[model samples]
Target: MDYKCTLDNADSFLNQLKLHRDRKEKVAVLSDLGGWERAEGMIREIVHKAGADYLVLDNGSALDIAKIVAVNGVFKTDCSC
Candidate 1:
Protein backbone atom coordinates (compact mmCIF):
# COMPACT_ATOMS: atom_id res chain seq x y z
CA MET A 1 0.00 0.00 0.00
CA ASP A 2 1.53 3.29 -1.12
CA TYR A 3 0.37 6.26 0.89
CA LYS A 4 1.40 9.90 0.77
CA CYS A 5 2.89 11.05 4.08
CA THR A 6 2.64 14.75 4.68
CA LEU A 7 3.34 16.58 7.94
CA ASP A 8 1.23 19.52 9.08
CA ASN A 9 3.82 20.70 11.63
CA ALA A 10 7.56 20.46 12.16
CA ASP A 11 7.57 18.50 15.39
CA SER A 12 4.75 16.33 14.24
CA PHE A 13 6.74 14.71 11.46
CA LEU A 14 8.14 11.99 13.72
CA ASN A 15 4.73 11.71 15.26
CA GLN A 16 3.43 11.08 11.76
CA LEU A 17 5.94 8.29 11.34
CA LYS A 18 4.64 6.92 14.63
CA LEU A 19 1.07 7.25 13.35
CA HIS A 20 2.06 5.30 10.28
CA ARG A 21 3.67 2.63 12.45
CA ASP A 22 0.59 2.33 14.62
CA ARG A 23 -0.85 0.69 11.54
CA LYS A 24 2.41 -1.25 10.97
CA GLU A 25 3.70 0.89 8.12
CA LYS A 26 7.38 1.32 7.42
CA VAL A 27 8.79 4.79 6.74
CA ALA A 28 11.96 6.87 6.54
CA VAL A 29 12.27 10.53 7.45
CA LEU A 30 15.07 12.88 6.38
CA SER A 31 15.05 16.39 7.82
CA ASP A 32 15.91 18.68 10.78
CA LEU A 33 16.29 18.04 14.52
CA GLY A 34 15.83 21.41 16.15
CA GLY A 35 12.13 21.12 15.50
CA TRP A 36 11.83 17.85 17.44
CA GLU A 37 9.99 18.33 20.66
CA ARG A 38 10.43 16.16 23.78
CA ALA A 39 6.89 15.07 24.22
CA GLU A 40 5.88 11.87 26.02
CA GLY A 41 5.22 8.85 23.78
CA MET A 42 6.36 11.09 20.94
CA ILE A 43 8.39 8.22 19.56
CA ARG A 44 6.75 5.12 21.01
CA GLU A 45 5.23 3.89 17.78
CA ILE A 46 8.38 4.72 15.86
CA VAL A 47 10.49 2.65 18.23
CA HIS A 48 8.14 -0.29 17.78
CA LYS A 49 8.60 -0.12 14.03
CA ALA A 50 12.33 -0.14 14.55
CA GLY A 51 12.36 -3.60 13.02
CA ALA A 52 11.93 -1.70 9.77
CA ASP A 53 14.13 0.96 11.37
CA TYR A 54 12.36 4.19 10.44
CA LEU A 55 15.06 6.83 10.70
CA VAL A 56 14.91 10.55 11.28
CA LEU A 57 17.93 12.18 9.62
CA ASP A 58 19.21 15.22 11.46
CA ASN A 59 22.18 14.85 9.29
CA GLY A 60 23.41 13.44 13.38
CA SER A 61 21.06 14.39 16.21
CA ALA A 62 19.52 10.91 16.68
CA LEU A 63 16.49 13.08 17.29
CA ASP A 64 15.14 14.35 13.94
CA ILE A 65 12.70 13.86 11.03
CA ALA A 66 11.50 14.77 7.51
CA LYS A 67 9.06 17.49 8.28
CA ILE A 68 7.00 18.72 5.35
CA VAL A 69 5.57 21.05 7.93
CA ALA A 70 7.82 23.57 9.70
CA VAL A 71 6.10 25.36 12.51
CA ASN A 72 4.00 28.27 11.15
CA GLY A 73 3.10 26.20 8.05
CA VAL A 74 3.08 22.80 6.27
CA PHE A 75 2.89 20.97 2.98
CA LYS A 76 -0.17 19.64 1.21
CA THR A 77 -0.57 15.97 0.27
CA ASP A 78 -0.74 15.19 -3.45
CA CYS A 79 -0.92 11.57 -4.56
CA SER A 80 -1.46 11.83 -8.27
CA CYS A 81 0.78 9.82 -10.47
Candidate 2:
Protein backbone atom coordinates (compact mmCIF):
# COMPACT_ATOMS: atom_id res chain seq x y z
CA MET A 1 0.00 0.00 0.00
CA ASP A 2 1.18 3.49 -0.78
CA TYR A 3 1.31 5.56 2.40
CA LYS A 4 1.84 9.27 2.25
CA CYS A 5 3.36 10.93 5.27
CA THR A 6 1.05 13.56 6.70
CA LEU A 7 -0.78 14.27 9.92
CA ASP A 8 -3.86 12.71 8.41
CA ASN A 9 -2.02 9.53 7.64
CA ALA A 10 -0.27 9.25 11.00
CA ASP A 11 -3.17 7.72 12.81
CA SER A 12 -3.90 5.44 9.90
CA PHE A 13 -0.31 4.27 9.89
CA LEU A 14 -0.34 3.60 13.61
CA ASN A 15 -3.62 1.76 13.27
CA GLN A 16 -2.21 -0.38 10.50
CA LEU A 17 0.73 -1.26 12.72
CA LYS A 18 -1.56 -2.16 15.55
CA LEU A 19 -3.65 -4.31 13.27
CA HIS A 20 -0.59 -6.17 12.15
CA ARG A 21 0.40 -6.74 15.76
CA ASP A 22 -3.09 -7.89 16.65
CA ARG A 23 -2.87 -10.50 13.98
CA LYS A 24 0.37 -11.78 15.52
CA GLU A 25 2.20 -10.46 12.49
CA LYS A 26 5.59 -8.83 12.64
CA VAL A 27 5.42 -5.07 12.13
CA ALA A 28 8.55 -2.97 11.61
CA VAL A 29 9.80 0.52 10.95
CA LEU A 30 12.39 0.49 8.16
CA SER A 31 14.56 3.55 7.68
CA ASP A 32 18.02 4.60 6.63
CA LEU A 33 20.39 5.01 9.58
CA GLY A 34 20.13 8.75 9.34
CA GLY A 35 16.75 9.03 7.76
CA TRP A 36 15.04 10.05 10.95
CA GLU A 37 18.08 10.75 13.06
CA ARG A 38 16.59 13.65 14.97
CA ALA A 39 13.52 11.64 15.81
CA GLU A 40 15.14 8.22 16.02
CA GLY A 41 14.58 7.77 19.73
CA MET A 42 11.01 8.96 19.51
CA ILE A 43 10.35 6.80 16.49
CA ARG A 44 11.72 3.72 18.17
CA GLU A 45 9.68 4.43 21.28
CA ILE A 46 6.51 4.79 19.24
CA VAL A 47 7.07 1.69 17.19
CA HIS A 48 8.03 -0.39 20.18
CA LYS A 49 5.11 1.07 22.10
CA ALA A 50 2.90 -0.23 19.35
CA GLY A 51 4.65 -3.61 19.55
CA ALA A 52 6.61 -3.30 16.36
CA ASP A 53 10.27 -3.69 15.48
CA TYR A 54 12.49 -0.82 14.38
CA LEU A 55 15.22 -1.42 11.81
CA VAL A 56 17.88 0.84 10.36
CA LEU A 57 19.28 0.35 6.90
CA ASP A 58 22.83 1.51 7.45
CA ASN A 59 24.36 0.16 4.25
CA GLY A 60 21.69 -2.13 2.99
CA SER A 61 20.46 -2.05 -0.58
CA ALA A 62 16.91 -1.97 -1.87
CA LEU A 63 16.93 -5.73 -2.26
CA ASP A 64 18.05 -6.14 1.33
CA ILE A 65 15.28 -3.89 2.50
CA ALA A 66 12.77 -5.85 0.43
CA LYS A 67 13.99 -9.10 1.89
CA ILE A 68 13.46 -7.72 5.39
CA VAL A 69 9.95 -6.59 4.55
CA ALA A 70 9.15 -9.91 2.99
CA VAL A 71 10.24 -11.70 6.10
CA ASN A 72 8.78 -9.24 8.55
CA GLY A 73 5.18 -8.93 7.37
CA VAL A 74 4.47 -5.15 7.35
CA PHE A 75 6.30 -1.90 7.93
CA LYS A 76 5.18 1.67 8.54
CA THR A 77 7.49 4.56 7.95
CA ASP A 78 7.62 8.24 7.04
CA CYS A 79 8.41 7.33 3.44
CA SER A 80 5.94 8.86 1.05
CA CYS A 81 5.35 8.11 -2.60
State candidate 2's TM-score.
0.29
Per-residue C-alpha lDDT of model 1 across residues 1-81, encoded as one tens digit per residue: 855545434234545555654665443333334443432222333332444333333232243344232312233343122
Write down the TM-score of every candidate: 0.30, 0.29
Model 2: ten consecutive residues of lowest lDDT: 37-46
The C-alpha stretches of model 2 lying farther than 4 A from their native spots are 1-12, 36-81
Model 2 over residues 30-72: C-alpha lDDT tens digits? 4335342111111112233234443322233121222121123
Structure candidate 1, residue pairs in collision:
none
Who wins the lDDT comparison? 1
What's the distance in Å from true for residue 4, model 2?
A: 12
Deviation in angstroms for 69 in model 1? 7.4
